[model samples]
Target: MARSYSSYIVAQSKRTPCLQNVCQFISDDCRKHDCKIVSLEFFAQDEKPRRTDLDQLNLEALLNTDVCGCQGRLIIVEDLSTAVIETLGSCLDIDPLFFASQIHGPTFDIVSSKPSDAILPSRALSQNFLSVQYQRTVDFGACSSAPRKMLRNSNVPRKIVLLPPIKNRSIGLEQQSCSILLSTTKSKPWLGLILVDKPNSDKYTTSEKQLVLPSTPFQGGYEDFSERPCFFEPDSGSPGRVSLLEDLVYYWEKERPPAFQPDQPTLLSLTYYPLKIAAAEWVSYVAVISHSIKQFEYSTEATFEEHGLRKIDSDLRSLEVWGRRCLQTSSKLQSAISFLKYQINGAPELEEYSLMIRDFEYIADLVTTYGRRLEIMVPVVTSVLQITDTRRSLKEAANVTRLTYLALLFVPLSFVASLFSMNGGVSAHDLTIYFAVALPLCAMVFFVTRLPTFDFVPLGPAFGKFGNWMRKAL
Candidate 1:
């Protein structure tokens, strides 16, 4: 056979007589419906009069109660006393679900009706008959006509009654339509209410606040509810202002990992905003340096032939200036890194900036290394070009001088030969003697022709091999 189940509603009141009357009413209703009354418990502090101490009560009254062989229903009624509300407001840690039922109980199935002329009796009687319970009188003149009925009909307790609206202001209404309402009372420390406004379908629209009571406790620190200090606000002197060095010290003290020691090189990262600015500056400096070096290379290539030595000397000076400037910029970058490191010591997000600075430092070192090589190569190449130019000029001069001397010696010889040939030879022996003399002169001419024209070797073949190798390698 299927077993019958009973529902248990847990409630609390300001006094025991009120609690007993409510329990008796619920029990009578359950008996009329052929359902059994499982159990009912009241939660209240011991210091108050007519209060039941749930902590000292018998556990079996609540634990052994059966409801359809399932977990018995738990209905909690909380009296929102003034003390309870004040205690809840001051506490940061409290469960929000325990007070949800009482705040939302009256609105479970309220029906709309016109304002009535009849007055409700302010008194009631209970089975125990020890005390007469009087309903708390509420002044509806302070409330709007629409919500006044809902408030008057709700008989939960005097302490939990919703207060009437303050004059000149709409009570329980939020400025923003989408905003939620939060409620706190001393009796239930952890509960909060989320009130929403739902659109009405009726032509006669009335402003109604729908309360959303959370069924669970809110889990977070009290600081979560505290407001952060505004940027423009003056400091409250809680702690002194943070300086760059102080910031670094604080991070080094607080956030530095246990494995990290003061002796080890600390890596500081940069925030995106500062890092981007620094990167832009570094890139601009690099571009300027590159342009200056390119100008030097251009000057070197242009005046190499005409102003060979002088142009190279000028280029050397310019390169040195560029190197000095690069060094200066590098120093500035180092200083920036140091400053930013101090600022970003404890900041985890800005760590990348430190890496970027390190990379820029490496680039600066590379530039310095290359600058040294350029210094050496500039003078060497200039000397080689000068020596090559001098050798070419001397070779041309030697060729011209050799041709002039040869012409001077041959011109007279040619004239004498011509004079001797023009005259009739007196005898064969005389002609033979003249021929022998001419033969010796011709032999000397041949010997002079065999002599090298210039002392320096021709540059064409030697330089051609070098040029060809360079082309292939490049």
Candidate 2:
């Protein structure tokens, strides 16, 4: 008997009512069909999702994921709301499935949200710094009979910086979207490298209109290469597709060395910006973290230690996720470069590749440095926290000692006063009453110490008014 099909209900996830258009039966419904797969992308220009659905839509799909190996779910948001962060935390709280569960708990990782407070470099990336060889043929050959100085800048440090956004930045190269080439024989798509961005009026220059050509399939017109560029639409639905867009990139993969195993199907929107802009964002992310690390490393006061450590840990995780993503992204861009070389003869694609590689190198080093720094600092920070706890324990012990002495002073009086109430040799009965009074009194004293409220601070009235206003406002 043929299996019956469920109505196309655009089923909502049990996690949230606001979550809609979930592809519930795609895999089963198309099992026997000609293997048609449709993947969708919500670009950076699209409107943000409603606040309520934020948790269930992206997060719910991301948790039960199998993407590139040794990574966690990454959600890049324009606005970092408490709800979103909380949702992300819950999604990562625990991987319940036997296959998905790797790290005991909390797998979802968010790399960045909002504009970074990075100590941004003054110059645009294009003008940041080019390698310049300063050389002079000196007659010092006469002074030493041979060149005394064979100084080569082998270990010269390049400034890793987040550049300020450029205005009227010449329309970055016009590129084509990815496409698949069809064959009459066996069925399998030839994955193509796609264009990541297009020239926009605000960012790209007017010259782009003429320089940029519409994407077209190869027709043996290889001589006039400027008219076409190779671009492939990334298929998010299949894990076997080596080149992946941000939306399809997996958070957690169990495989080692991350081989191409496109067996899983994923559906969700990801934060996708132009490649250049994404690189810029990642750089700023690193710079801001580096700055924050510097602040903690140099500060003389202990005041920043507590909150600072939390921030440090959070940023560290972000770096680790960002690093893996960059590594994967860089590998994929190589194909793009090769395609550019073929499509646009004598294009400066190699230079662009170098720039990306340089940034990638910096990103890798930053992650390594941060990881080592954190490994060292974690122990030291833990010791400091332990010391704090010891100090607090000692203070509490001292207070307890004082209370014990005061209780001793009343012991004889309380006993003698209770003697009168006891019918001769009914002292045990009176003792039970004594415990009732003493137990309550001790409990009150112990718990009162924990309360932040003090007699001198009249904060109740003001706090009450604030609470009332907040309730009305909400």
Instruction: Report model 2's TM-score to 2 decimal places.
Output: 0.28
Model 2 lDDT tens row, 159-199: 11111112211111111122111111121221111112111
Off by over 4 Å in 2: 1-275, 291-352, 411-474
Model 1 residue 168 distance off true place after TM-score fit, in angstroms = 81
Residue 281 shift from truth in candidate 1, angstroms: 3.9
TM-score of 1: 0.29
What lDDT does candidate 2 reach at residue 271?
Answer: 14
User: Each model's TM-score, in the order given?
Assistant: 0.29, 0.28
Error of 2 at 218 (Å): 40
RMSD value for candidate 1: 35.3
Residue 399 alpha-carbon offset, candidate 2, angstroms = 0.8
| After superposition, candidate 1 runs with Cα above 4 Å error | 1-275, 287-314, 342-349, 352-356, 404-443, 446-474
